[model samples]
Target chain A: MLKDKKNYKLIVVEDNIGDFILFEEYLNEKIENPTLFHFERFKDLNDFQDKITPDFDIIFLDLSLPDKNGLDLIIEVQKISKQIPIIVLTGYSDESFATTSLALGISDYLLKDDLNSTTLYKSIIYNIERNKNLVKIRESEQLYSDLFQLSPLPICVYDIETLLFIDVNEAAVNLYGHSHSEFLNLKVDDIFHDEEIDKTEEIASKIMTHKKKNGEIIFVDSRSNTITFNGKKAKIILSNDITKSLNHIREIELQNQKLKEIAWKQSHIVRVPLSQILGLTQLILDDKETTQETKELIIILNNSAKELDKIIQEIITKSKEISLNE
Target chain B: MKHLFIIDDDAVSVLILKKMLSNADFLETPMVFYNGNEALNFFSKNYTSVDTYCVFLDINMPVMNGWEFLDNIQTTIHPNNFMVYLLTSSTSEYEKSKSNDYHCIKKFISKPISKEILNEIKEVFNSI
Candidate 1:
C-alpha cells in the first residue's frame, strides 16, 4: 500500500515499442504517478545522457538494441547511470548471457517472456536497495585503502607461506632504500641480517637486526599480525627504527662503568696516602718535645689533609650513585 | 692481665697507635705485627686463654689480609678471650658491612685513629 503511493522515476531503453509499453504497465501497477522516459535505441540514450541525473532511480535496458546491444549497451548505460541501478530485459534464448551480464556490473536481469507486473516491480525494488548498499561498501573500502597508503611508519604485507613481499607502503620503500618494484621482488628475509633471518618466523612484536640496501645494519622494533591480503594468507608488519636510542643506552652504560672504576680507585688507592699524612701530622701535634712553631705548621698541615680527605669522600659518594639507567 | 696487639703494614700508622695507647695510659705495652701472617704466627705460638687479648687489625697488607686472618683465627681461638677491632683506611661501605659477618670483631674503625677513639677502646676493654 505504501509502495503504491510513491512516485518512481524510471528510464526504459528498448528498440520495440510493445516491450517498453509492457514494462511501463508493470511499473505503474506498483508505483503511482511514475515518471518514465523511453529511448528507442542505445544512441538515443547516449544523446540524452547529459540530461540523465542521479534522481532517475533505475534504467531498464533491452539486451538486443538496433545499433548497440549486449555487453556494450550495458557498459555505455552504466557509464551514464553512475550510481543509478540498471536491470537488463532479455529474451529466454539470452538467459545465460543475461546471467553473465550480472558479473559485468548489471544489478539484475529479467526475461521478457517472464514479463508480469509483479516480477518487474520486484526487480526494480530489490536492485535499487542493493545498489545503495554496494555504494556504501565501496566508499568504506576506499577509505581503508587510503589509510594504508598514507601511513607514516613503515608497513609491509607479505605472503606467510612464500615469505615474499606482497605489498609495501611509501614509508617502507623509503626506509629500506628500495624502489616499489624492487621491494615486491624481495622476500621478507632479504631485509634481515644473515644471523637474524632464521628467526623470522617468530618476528611478532620484537626487536630485530635488519640490513638496508646500502649495507647499513639497523635495529627495528617489528610488530606483525596475520591478515588475509588479496585472497592470500599474509602477514602485515609495522617497523619502528630504534637504533639511535639503543646506542645511546649502551653509551651511557659504558660511562657508568668508568665512573664506578673511578669511585673504586678514590676509595682504595687514593685514601691510603692521605690517611698516613693525617696520622703522622696528629703524632707531631701531640708530641711534648716539638717546638711551638713546628707544632703550629703541623696543625695547618693536618687541616689541609682533612680537607682533601673530605673532597675524596664526596667524589666516591657521587660516583656510587651513577647507575646504569640514569 | 690484658694484652694489646697492633697489626699493620704502615710504620707511621703503627707508631701513632702505639703513642695514642701510651698517652691514654693503657698500662700494657702493645705488641706489634707487620701483617696478619705475623699476628697469626704469634697467636699460634703464644696464645693463652688465661689472659684477655685486645687486637687492632688493619685490612690491607702484602702477604695476608684482615679477612683471611679472621677466617683462620675463628677455628683456633675462642671469641670470648679475644676482642678484635678492625681498622681500615678505605672508606668502603661494602667492607664495613662485611665486617658484621665476623663474631670476634668488636668494632669497625676508620683510620688515622684519634685519641678519643683509643679512649673509647680502653673503656670497652675495662668494662669487659
Candidate 2:
C-alpha cells in the first residue's frame, strides 16, 4: 500500500551510499530530501552538523557509520536534535545493536534483510503515528490538568536531575490540601511519612522512594523511563495513597490470625480421630494378621470411628458458636 | 525411679504407646490410663506418692477429653514441670495452639507414633 501520502520531510543520515540507494529503492520513492546529508566517516558527521534542519519529520540512522559505532553516533545525533522521530537502519550482522540504539531514544529499527519497499513505507508510517500519539498524550495531560484539581489519588511526575515536579494530577492537590501550584512548590520527600513507608514497602530505590507532604509521608513507586518533558529529560511516576488501606488491612490480618489459631486446632486435634481411623483401617486391611488379631482390630476401629463421629458433632457446634459471634 | 503416665481410650493405642516408651527406656515403670478421667482419677488418688515426670495424653476420648484433662491439671495435685507429649492423629491447627496453653506440655506428636517419633521423644529427653 502507498503511504498515507505523507509529504513528510525525511532526513537520511546513513554513511553507506549503497544502503542509502537501497533505502530509497526500498521506499520506492521518486522524491528525495533537499537537505539529505551523506557521511561515510565520523568527520563527515561533524562537518555537516549545522546543516541539519528543525522541520525534518523522520531521521533514518545507521549505527555503524565510520565516525562512530553503536550508541556514540546515535548520541551525537540526539545531541543535535531529539524532537524528530528516529528510524535505525542496520545490516543483519549488527541487528542486535538496534535494540540499544532504540533504548537510547531511536524510534524504530529496520533490518536490512527485511527492508522491502512496503516495510520501509510501513516503518515510516508507524514511527510517525507513534510520534503523533506521544504528542497527543502530552497535550491531553496538559489540557486536563485543571480537571484533576481534586483527584483523590494525587500523582506527581518530576525530573530526576531537577527534582522538580513536571506535573501533578488533580487528586494529588486535594490529598495534599495544596493547589496545583503549591504541589509544584514542594519536593517529593517534603510530605512523605516515614511510618507509612515502613508500613508499606521502602519506596527508596531511585526506582522508588518515600517523601513527606503536609507533615505526612507519601510513597512514590517510580519506573525509570526516558521521556522529553518540557524539552528536558524527566521521569513519569504513578503514585497511590495507601494510608487508609494500610491500616484497614492490619485489622483484617489480626482477625485472620484469630481464625487461623482456631483453624490450627482444627488441623491438629480435630483430624486426630480421622487419621486414627485411616491408620487403623490400614492395620485391619493387612492380611498378615491372625483372625483373632483382626477381630480385636475391628473392635478398636469401631470404637475410634464412633468417637470421631461424636468429636465432629462437638466441633460443628463450637464452630457454629464462633461463626455466630463473628 | 521415673514413672510416666499414658492416657489413651484405645487399648491398641495404649499398647503401642506402652511398647514405644518401654523400648526407648523412658522410665522404670510407666502406668497406663485407658481414658483421661481414669488418669485424672489416678492422679487425684496418688496426690503426692509417685514422682511422675511426663504424661503421654490422647486428645479424643469418652467421659473427659484431653483439653478437659489439661484444664483439670491446673486444679489437680499434679505439680508443674511435668511435660505432656500429645500422642494423637490430630493435625488440627486448634490442637497445636492448644498445646501452647498447657505450659507443662512439651510437644505434640502426630500418630501413628512411629520409631521416628520415638527418636524425637528421646532427643527431647536427652535435651532436658
Candidate 3:
C-alpha cells in the first residue's frame, strides 16, 4: 500500500530481455508506478546519454552488456549518470569483483539471482541517500579549498616536526619569489632570516624579518596556528607584509623629532635677544632725562619688538601643532 | 630686613630689572649674581630665618641653571622666608608648569620684567 503512493524514475542498461523484465517487475512491486527507461545495449545508453537529466533518481546498470561489459560499462554509465546513484546488477556472485566495482564509485553491487523487490528497493534508497551526502561533503571541501587558494594574504603550511613547507597559496608564491615546487623543497627556516629562525616559536602576531629567494629582506606581521594537514601535524602561517607601514611610522617620528628641536631653538635661543631689545627700549622710554623725540622713537621700537615676539610665539605654537599631528 | 636678589647671566636684563625696581620706588637695592651657583653660595652664607628674601631668577644660565638653584636650596630655604620669581625669556609652557614643582617658587614671570610685574613683586615683599 505504501509502494503504490510512490513513483520512481529509473534507467536500466541490460542486453538480456529476461533480466531487464525481471528488474522492471521487481521495481514495480516496490514502487507502484515506476518510470523505467530500458536500454538493451551500452551503445543505446550512450546514444541516449544526451537526453539524460538529473530527474532520473536511480540507475540499474548491468555489469555485462552486449556492446560493453564489466568495468568499461560501469565507467561509461557513471559518466552519464553524474550525481545519480548507480547499483551494479550482475549474475555472478564474485565477491572480489563486487568490492572492486564499489571502489570504482559504484553506489552498490547486487547479484541478479539474489535480487528481490525488497532488496532492490533497499539498495536504491540507501545508495541515493549516501550519494547525496557525498555530494554535500565534496561541495564543502571545494569551498574550504577555494578560501585557502584565493586569499590575498600570503599563507603557507609547514610540517611541525621538520618545518618543511608543505603547501603554499598563489599569494605566498608571489610574495616570497619562489615557485610552488621550489617552496615544497625549502623548509620554513630557509625563508626566515638566519637570526630569526631561532625565535620562530615566538613569532606569532609579531613583526619579524624574512628573506626572499633573491636574498631581499622584508618585514612581515606573522600569525600561525597548528593544524593536521594531509595526515601530518603542521602549522599554517599567514604573513602580512608591514615593511612599508613600519617605515612610514619611523619617518614620521624622525620628522617629529626635528620639529621638536626647531621648537626648542625658537623658544630658548631666538627669544633671548628679542626680550633684551624689549627691555632696553622700555628702560629708555622710562628715563626722565631722555628727550621727548627720543622717547617717541623708543616707543615705536618697543612696539616692533613686541610684534616680533608675537610672531615667534606663533611659530612655536604652529611647530607644536605639526608635531602633534604627526 | 627684606632682601632682593637678581640671579641672571645677562647684564642688560639685570640692568633693566634694577632700573624698573628703582622706578617702582623699592627701598632695598638688589644684589646681583651671574648664575645659580653664585646665588646658591650667597644663600648658604647669608641665609637667615628672620630676613625675607625675594629672588628674580633666570632659567637658561651657563653654569648652574635656575632649576639647579631651586633643587639645591629647596631643603634649606623656608617657604615663608623666601619667594622665588622665575624670570625667563624662554616661552615654554613646560618650564612654567615645571616651576610649580618647587614650593619656594612663588610666581613665573616672562621677561623682560615689566613695571606692573615689579610692582606686584614689591607688594609681596611689602606685605611680608
True contacts kept of each: 0.75, 0.50, 0.84
Instruction: Give the TM-score (vs. native) of candidate 2.
Output: 0.32
TM-score per candidate: 0.59, 0.32, 0.65
lDDT for each residue of candidate 1 in A1-326, tens digit (9 for 90 to 100):
65576768888888898888788777777888888889998889999989998888899889999999888888778888866888888999999999999899888989999899889888888888897899899999988987887788899999988889999988888888988899999988888885444433546677888888898998999888888999998889888888999999999888878888889889877898898899889878888999999999999999999999999999877876774336
CA RMSD of each candidate after superposition:
7.3, 20.6, 6.9
Best by TM-score: 3
lDDT of 1: 0.86
In terms of lDDT, the best-performing candidate is 3
Q: On residues B1-128, what C-alpha lDDT tens digit does candidate 2 reach at each position?
A: 34577788877676656655666666546778877888888777765634546778888888998989888966764444466889786655556787887777778877766666676766665555
lDDT of each prediction vs. the true structure?
Answer: 0.86, 0.67, 0.87
TM-scores of chain A across the candidates, in order, are 0.69, 0.43, 0.79
Docking class of predicted structure 2: incorrect
Which regions in candidate 2 have their CA more than 4 angstroms from the true location?
A1-6, A29-35, A41-54, A142-326, B1-128
lDDT of 2 at A3: 34
The collision pairs in model 1 are none
The regions of model 3 sitting more than 4 angstroms off are: A1-4, A40-55, A66-69, A93-95, A143-154, A174-179, A195-204, A213-216, A269-273, A276-280, A283-301, A314-326, B1-89, B93-128
